[model samples]
Target: MNAQPLLEVRDLHLSVRAPNGNRAPVLRGVDLSLARGQVLGLVGESGGGKTMVGKAILGVLPDGARVERGSILFDGKDVLAMPGSARRMLSGKSMSMILQNPMTALNPVMRIEDQITDVLRLHMRMDKAAARERALEMLDAVQIRDPRRVLRQYPHELSGGMCQRVVIAIAFACNPALIVADEPTTALDVTVQHQVLRLIRDLQMKSQTCVLFVTHDLGVVAKVCDAVSVIFAGRIIESGPVREVFEAPRHRYTRALLEAAPRYDRPETALHPISPALREELTQEIVHTYRIPGHAV
Candidate 1:
């Protein structure tokens, strides 16, 4: 309890410029915190403002979306209040992000070696040989069997899973204190998704890094998150320990989301219509959002 939070979003309010140039609030007084080595899952439909919060933390907002109000503190320092130079220095060294799409995060022209080495050079200032060595070591740590081959290959040369592993390698290379993984397993096949999720969990535990895992899948959240925050219509309506929230959901939207999720052992049948109340909530404000321009192939 005495340890300072790795990251906190206090009473955050975000807004986007509409076509008429009026500000429409996208995030409504969000409050979230994560300590070192903790994982907090943010689960909701696509326009619930989960990604907006993550982007605000990263200082990378989509078009017209701005953090109009709030404080984003990281390890007792206010990130949104920091000067540009300090923020740049702190980002790669103390905080890192793994996007959902591997292809978009990686550069097709640059070899994986250069991509990771650039991070090392910018953050750690390692020599050429040392940086390359570190890059290979990270590739191996992320379970890439042929580390040298991966290092030499361009992003387009690798399979989707391999490219995603490369992204994971970059994110973990600096042993960052906080990592925001936004839908990291999206678009992968079921088998690959399980493998990648396991890898992320193992790495998070081993590195003692706090994670803000933003995903739409409740099953994924159940497997990875120690705590759960259910957001709807740009507001966090419910939050608690994952088990508590799952066992006794207090919010109507959370209940509807749980109801819509399929059960494995139960017989397959027509999905019960999600309650009109929740459906209205989801579609009323924002229908959907795409955080990444082009997701992984």
Candidate 2:
């Protein structure tokens, strides 16, 4: 492992404007680090601010969202402090994202070739013919059959799995240093999800690209991630190596999550859902720690 991490997020505090025009804290002092060639899984329940961490790193936070404090350092440079042009230049070429839904991530009307080639042309500075050829190669790299034909087709013409493959291809097209994959397999079926996970792991290994995999699935994290961070109520309560955390989780919430997740090996075991008391306790802890007025965890 590299001594210096490829990406580092330190004490990130974020707030989003609520309907009443008040800023509600979304991410409360999030700290994360991903070394080179590592896959770090951000695991948490929905709305726990997992996706916001990725968005903050990508500089693509939605309207009304603001990062109030802390810095995101990528390759020793603070991305949060970078100029707009520098950040924009670094985003597509040095870093990229594989979004949750491929259908929505891709343009509906654009042909596959154009979508893939556009990134290459813009970031890699490839000419038309070179970009087109590279696009075909990328499609093939993602194991898409009949790359030439698929390139001519629109996103709607492809299966969900195929569309995801295309998105993965685009994400890896520039050989980016880091990729923030936010629930990339949530929209796919079990078999396809397995395939996609394997594909991502394989590509990450081949290119040695660091990845921040954001997902709610512990099973997925076990299979794909080297390290895992458990987020709750806008805070990372527990984080460590996958085997260590899974076998001996330190936090109550981490243990509760593990118990709640279905285990194929223990089919007869009863599922234990997280209790409301625990949720309330964690929320109270957050409130006490931050002392943010009117903040809803």
Candidate 3:
């Protein structure tokens, strides 16, 4: 058994070259480590490179983006240095991702049965009937009541929440040692988000799987993550135990992100936008017209 960290991302510097050949560094030497059975939360605003970090570990960079430096080690081996064949072998059964958009992740043309069976066949070497049973069981495990019908249906037939759950079911069905969930509840209604999150937590505890949860919602991070990292401008400016960060934020960015989230102490108007000049300088964005300057909205 390997006692090494399940996933260790060294000073990872990632960048993208635009069509005009301008280079943009999205992740500036971001470092994170996850041992087996731990959960690490990456929180930040949109375009802050939270998702990019997760994708980098999965070897799925966006168009034009490349990992300029650093190594992602999983179970004591460098993921990038491994052969493509070895990485492919390690993905589904060892590591998997629950993408932010289930509609895009699941195939519209394929039945859910076939979609899951593909994993079983290619990764687990299971026969058709066994894979089919496992796929249905997986649906049930994720709390999809109509497991059989769902297995026979295409992704388009399911609601967005259902589709997201299906994505979770498929990704988590085989108990991969590590799971990278990018906004695991983005598509669900507010009511179902908790259920989905609870499902992830329950499964994580059961499987002792390390999870790197990426989301812009600090509320979600508060509910799930054991440890949290607050990212800004592609840098982890603050990080610590969830309780400590929530109670006593060390970084100004972290404090601002929390103060921006609705709070009982703050008056409702605290969310009003600050002067365009102030925001532009802080976030490099001109569109945040309603956020109060000292805190968040």
Candidate 4:
């Protein structure tokens, strides 16, 4: 690991306003660090506050959600403390995000070329012609054939895989220092998933870009991650290099995840869910540890 990481989230706490005038805690004291030129996998079950961590980092928390405490530091600068104008400038320039759903993330009314070129023009200050050329180059880099044709089309006209490729193009277009890839391949088929994963890895290697790869799939984590963090009940229970954690997971929750995941090599292996008792115990511990005053857990 590098002595200085490209991105770091320390003691992060977030809450969402419920329908009945209540705030429910989502993330509790979550800490993560991504070293420069490395992919750090955040593996956990769904609804475990994994996606919220990424949103918090980008300062894009959803409606009724707010950051209660903690700091998001990118390149040793405190993003949480930055002024609104400065933070807006920092987004998509020094830091960018590849959302899970490409079509929803993109504008339905805009053409693909216009969408991509907008980023280049806004951040790089390139002229329209130059931005268009670079956008085409990026599409080609992501292995999109007939880049000209695709550029003219909207998100609805392209396949899910192609849309994902375009999203990746936009994310890497500016060569941002850090990328938050929140399950970018979850919607694609196995073949497309493989290709997208390969594209991300190749781009990261070529540019030395740091990535926070968020997913529940352990198999994908093993394939592309340099280091892995196991998040359970909004807490990071265990984290280390991929090989070390996979071979010898310290936390029982981590071991449970590995046991539950389907393995192609072990065709007859039975999948076992983590014990309910253990899950309840962990949940209670989190509730107890992060209990806020005047707020029900």
Candidate 4, 133-244: lDDT as tens digits:
9999999999999999999999999999999999999999998988999998998899999999999999999999999999999988988999999998778899899999
Give the best candidate by TM-score.
Answer: 2
Give per-residue CA lDDT, model 3, range 178-202, as digits (tens): 8999998987788888888998888
State the local distance difference test value for candidate 3: 0.81
Residue 88 of model 3 has an lDDT of: 74
Across 82-138, the per-residue lDDT of candidate 2 in tens digits comes to 999999899868999999899999999999999999999999999999999999988
Give all candidates' CA lDDT scores: 0.84, 0.92, 0.81, 0.91
- List the lowest-lDDT window of 10 residues for candidate 4: 287-296
**What TM-score would each prediction reach against the true structure?**
0.91, 0.96, 0.88, 0.96
Please give the distance, in angstroms, between residue 156's alpha carbon in candidate 1 and its true position after superposition. Answer: 1.0
* Candidate 1, position 268, lDDT: 79
Model 2, which residues run further than 4 Å from truth? 291-297
Q: Which scores higher on lDDT, 2 or 3?
A: 2
Q: Write the per-residue lDDT of candidate 1 for residues 182-221, one digit (tens) a residue.
A: 9999968788999999999999999888899999888898
- Predicted structure 4, TM vs. truth: 0.96
Q: After superposing candidate 3 on the true structure, give the runs of residues whose Cα lies further than 4 Å from its correct spot.
A: 1-3, 263-297
- Candidate 4: which pairs clash? none
